[model samples]
Target: MASWSEAVEAAVRRHVAAAGSPFTRQALIDAELDAIVADVGSAGATPHQTLSRELQHLRDMGLLEFFAPGVYRWAGSLDEPMRAGTSKGVFVVGSHSIYQDEPERFYRFGPQWLPNASRIAGNWIIYQEPRRAGPRGYYAVAKVERIVPDPATEGMYLAVIEPGSYLELGRDVAFQFDGKAVERGLLNPDGRLNNGRAVQSIRTISDEDFNRIVGLGLIEDEDLLPRVDDPMPARVQEEHIPWEGPVDRATMLVSRTVRDRQFRKRVLDVYDCRCALTGMKLINGGGRAEAQAAHIKSVAAGGPDRVTNGIALSGTVHWMFDRGLISLSDEGAILLSRKINDIEGVSKLIYPNGRARLPGGVSRPDARYLEWHRRECFHA
Candidate 1:
């Protein structure tokens, strides 16, 4: 068994390796620090306390430094996240050079920037006018399709941003927002954007905003876009509605989008981003969940778009559930159909006790939903 420090280090390494951002304290806990603690001995305190102590210990050894309140950066870090070939976050760009407003395409910023540079793509734009300008916070989010030399100016790098939701800065900068960053507002008390230096060359947005905006197709996902009353957008343009293909199809599409967003968040929150049955928390390089939210009952059979109506599952289990090849008992035990056999190594994925771990949260696997699955959906 590894030592306690070694175990924590291993977990931290796993987190850093898998994540596009720096490892965070909560991330370490989510990465199974408790199991790491258990491997050595009983924790003298709660897992959080123990992990805190260990992380501080690592800090004292100069292996890491606190990047934010709960975020930690590994020592000698090389801005690994920025070099990921593509990044999704807000960036501050000055207005003077190559920023076309009419047919907004290519833009440039920070040829003189010492710390920040070009990443892969998918960068959001938050246009910052010179200090105390009216109608501040105008944004034209974009995707960097190609990086080329600035045609208008030779010294700067030009970013060709894809067409996205664009609104001018006539006036009105106060934002009504939520989550951690939103709670405090995007601008610091002195009217500068948070998460940057005094001059503010580039600013990384909160993860909440980054994920939502990027997921919504760089501002095109109008239905899922942040509901902001921008005074700058043309009134008729804002009022215009895109034509829906057909009523039933449109209904299905809207339901699907809502369900996809809401169900995934709720179910994943319950299991802490792990499969309820297998305890697998597969994540991509971006540290985003690879798990799927599955309906206990088929949507075609009247399954509701609800947390209680769903479960967080891995891809394979999701497929199996849809086919009635696997299901859940009324008591929340995992019930795999006999169709799964050792010949396929499918049995190995099953829990030894043939039970699923019930996640602790507001909404749970509703017994009614489970019964519906067992009756109509399950092959058994």
Candidate 2:
């Protein structure tokens, strides 16, 4: 009969050994308790109840965090020396559940983890809905392959991670938890809806459940929230200003209005309701959906402020592409500059094989823009 603290310490050690490293609570269940229960006489211990109690105790001590439902790991163990030869453990966890009333909006929970320190990942769960499509109950996981700050919106950042990583993490968590942790909602079984319609109404533990769990010491509160900043008012490109000559202020204002509207519509129609580069769809007013029109060729470069020269892009990708950090080929393939690829983890931006999605009616990219990108922007 081991004491409670002694039993917990021993179980933690055994669980870590079996997992080959520190792992979440589910890992403990999968690797140790399930088998330990069946093998009675060797250790002659009640491993299941003992491990659960010990985990609860640890949670109360503020040393662990529940990143998602039933998923947890060490939360405050930094300051100790890094384990020999191991990269500093850093991971990003994003979880989403859908609402029944407003299917477009998704409740998102994301937290960053540092192997032994306070989880540094942003904590605030934001309500973001897909822009192009309604809530379809699909979810993904990816590493934070890139983080780009928004120039127009202070404190707003864009993150690009491997899509495959997102899918893999979703699958792994689903498999390990036997669907208890993730609820993808009821499928129609008739398969009546389109491909994206598979996820109708996914639900997870509610906010109350989340707070209760946290209160019980099941998770940590880092108080990190998604920062939202309003976009700056649109401005004419600096180069386009005729500063050397006497300016017709009234004429300029009228000309700008017509051009801006034309550009906006063309970009919207060309993107066909989503970002051309990232495939981010738009949602209505609910902070959950987003889609913004973008210019493929700079307005400052004599590109017509019309659909023929515009593209629809998600707000984030638009900023990057406009800055010449990302581009598309004439055939709608992704093009990354050699300089971009040189950055750590930038390969994730390649999108598997350089594929790009264009609107059905729009012609291929203009040769002039493609040439310009190649000459001035393409890393080559």
Candidate 3:
């Protein structure tokens, strides 16, 4: 008993939810043409014309963005079933998981999540590790550049992480606070959790809820590190206070102030506050670290704000490294550029073994980024 337009809208939603967005007009026809062909029976309008009309309806409703003559991008939230210019979402990541998740690089997901994933394209996502996975709860956040089919595996897709956007939370936030579910969307009428919502690997998050998580995760600790350009070193003390105020999600994620704070925290934690080149752990009388976190590939060059793309260095060494006077090999060997006028002075600053001190595992500097520095910035 549905009208032709109603049936067309239903079919289109199903097709897009399953197939994802940024799709061509022909692709939609191919997936949904036959499903609603009956709706146009005995009418002068062809099924193709009917589908096109409904697509235009969706565009007018602000659910779709027309990119060209035939291409369209879905700009609606799949979970909430609403339209918006941008949407925020959550990604459930597990340690040693089945899906390939490079916390700072990309996230791999199956076809079932295409709709939810598309909702957050070109937007931010909060990364959480389930209790079963590890101690880190809502551990980090990153932006999704785009969604593309995984070349290595059929039916799988990758949400490419935006460069210089990934940042580990200053501290892990627990799922429940005072035995109440933190995510309001997951709470049932009786104050119990809707387990069905909790199990989803990809889900949309309300902006208010997203902001709350950011506040809890990135609360300033007493021992905050100084920014790269700070004239004076941070004075540290032994105190930690939980943030109990509202945070504007946009300001927290997009502002340079928060990005630098989160980036510095991740890099320093990875290297244990030691200079990678000289193996020095210098702390001033007030307890502020003299070791500075340097971008292996800088932000200006589209480098990611990830531990893999960062290295800790002393003040003088950081200046030299930033100026193309020094670099690092994939294997952690120091590479001094020909531009250095005082080789002996620089030599004394480096480790005696002539290798940069690097941590093992995923925290090590990524070779691709190091290669970029050698190719684009390093003098020789």
The residue pairs that clash in candidate 3, if any, are 164-304
* Residue-wise C-alpha lDDT for candidate 1, range 253-366, written one tens digit per residue: 233443354445656666777888787888765566767677786666656545667788887788888888888987888776777655246657856677887765435777
lDDT of 3: 0.74
> Which candidate gets the maximum TM-score versus the true structure?
3
Query: Model 1: clashing residue pairs?
Result: 85-120, 135-171
Cα RMSD (angstroms) for every candidate in the order listed: 25.1, 23.3, 10.0
Give lDDT for model 2.
0.40
- For candidate 2, the TM-score is 0.32
Model 3 TM: 0.70
Candidate 1 accuracy as lDDT:
0.53
lDDT of 3 by residue, 1-380 (tens): 12455445545666777887788889877886654443222233576776688888888988779988899887775533222226688899875688767777789987666656766788899998887644567878898888888788886888898876788776678898677767665665557666755777877677877887887788465355574356643422223448977556756676555666677778888888889899899877777788887888888877866678889999899998888888888898899888899999989989988998799886788899899988887888
CA displacement after TM-score superposition, residue 40 of candidate 2 (Å)? 99
Q: Which one is best on lDDT?
A: 3
Alpha-carbon runs more than 4 Å astray in model 2: 1-231, 234-254, 284-289, 341-350, 360-363
Q: What is the lDDT, from 0 to 100, of the residue 80 in candidate 2?
A: 26
